[model samples]
Target: MKFLASFLILTMLTITNSITAQNQNTATKTITVTVVNATSDTGKIGFALYTKDNFMRKPIQGKEGKIKNGKSTVVFENVPSGEYAITCYHDKNNNDRMDFSKNRMPLEDYGASNNVMAFAPPTFENAKFLLKDKNLELDIKF
Candidate 1:
């Protein structure tokens, strides 16, 4: 009787652990970012995903995609439910960085997650979006 009870308890524990692990796996979701108005398909589009703590300083994730029909798309996978912002720039010269003029103005086209166009730099509050139970898609124009 003791052996049978121990086996049943172990089996229940294993099943419960497996269910918890599966739930955790399903909690993470994907985010799709699309740059809608790239000037040309000359070079790759660079995308950066930022959390509030590291907004505009260092991106937690980064991706690059080629432009097609004046649009570029990137997918960020396995993003847990939280607030995130995105910034993307058209690397028109294929230099892997946004170009800047001598006066410190950006030469390359750039955009934020909320399509914010401002004289000053974008902030986390202005560009942040919540990633909850479902996947998200954003269209930003530059």
Candidate 2:
């Protein structure tokens, strides 16, 4: 009967759509950023993910992680494959923000991708890393 055939087709389509959605979810990548030498484990670590176009201005994703054993790790899950940079700092004062001294020097410890910290502020080019289909682990030293 036409009714039976239509019902079967609809059920098959529903199953197919579900499988496609699950595949899409698994396709996105994950990045694990580990920050080392956090001054202390009292406050949390603030991290930011940046792209070339939005470097230092706006972070596409920002998060906070608890420090343990003098280190903190942040995981960015379900990320699309692209080039991105990372910046993180140990919020020693529990102020939920980075503190700067009168001379513009960082009051707390900070780290960037590739452990890059040169004369100038961290540039996107200096800290950029490739995120592919597979997972990534980056170790940064402050």
Candidate 3:
């Protein structure tokens, strides 16, 4: 009888732990992004996500956002808790690089989130989110 009881207890513990882990994986928040007028009718837009520490990496790969026509809406899933920002540019030539004029000024349109607040490149603090418990929504313009 004692052996049976021990087996049952062990089974229960294993089942409970499995369920807890599954719940933890499912406990993710959704991010609602609206990329408006991302490009002119003849242009395409490229976007990227970056963590707080590595700010200089060009065209941050992975984490693909959706684009249809001139606008896009994306939901980044399974994002672990951290600081992040989104930056984008209008690639008129689809050349995978932001074209520049002779003056080094962007010949193509470029933008970032929270662009309304400043004239400088936005800091992580300006765009960071806790994303610990619920969904988030942000609107970006170019």
* TM-score to true structure, per model: 0.84, 0.79, 0.67
**Please, what are the lDDT tens digits per residue for candidate 2 over residues 25-138?**
568788899897877798999999988899898798898999999989999887887899999889988898889989998888888998888856788888999886689998
Worst 10 residues of 3 by lDDT: 58-67
Residue 24 in model 3: lDDT: 76
In angstroms, the error of model 3 at 41 is 2.6
Q: What C-alpha lDDT values do all the predictions have?
A: 0.92, 0.88, 0.67
Query: lDDT of candidate 1?
Result: 0.92
Q: Report the candidate with higher TM-score, 1 versus 2.
A: 1
Q: After superposition, how far is residue 134 of candidate 2 from its true place, in Å?
A: 0.5
Query: What lDDT does candidate 3 reach at residue 30?
Result: 62
Q: Tens digit of lDDT per residue, candidate 1, span 1-142?
A: 9999999999999999999988975698999999988899999999999999999888989999999999999999989989899998999989998899999999998889988789877888889999988999999988
Instruction: Single out the weakest 10-residue window by summed lDDT for candidate 2.
Output: 21-30
Give the C-alpha miss distance for residue 75 in model 2, angstroms. 0.6
RMSD of 1: 3.1
What residue pairs are clashing in model 2?
none
For candidate 2, the per-residue lDDT at 128 reads: 97
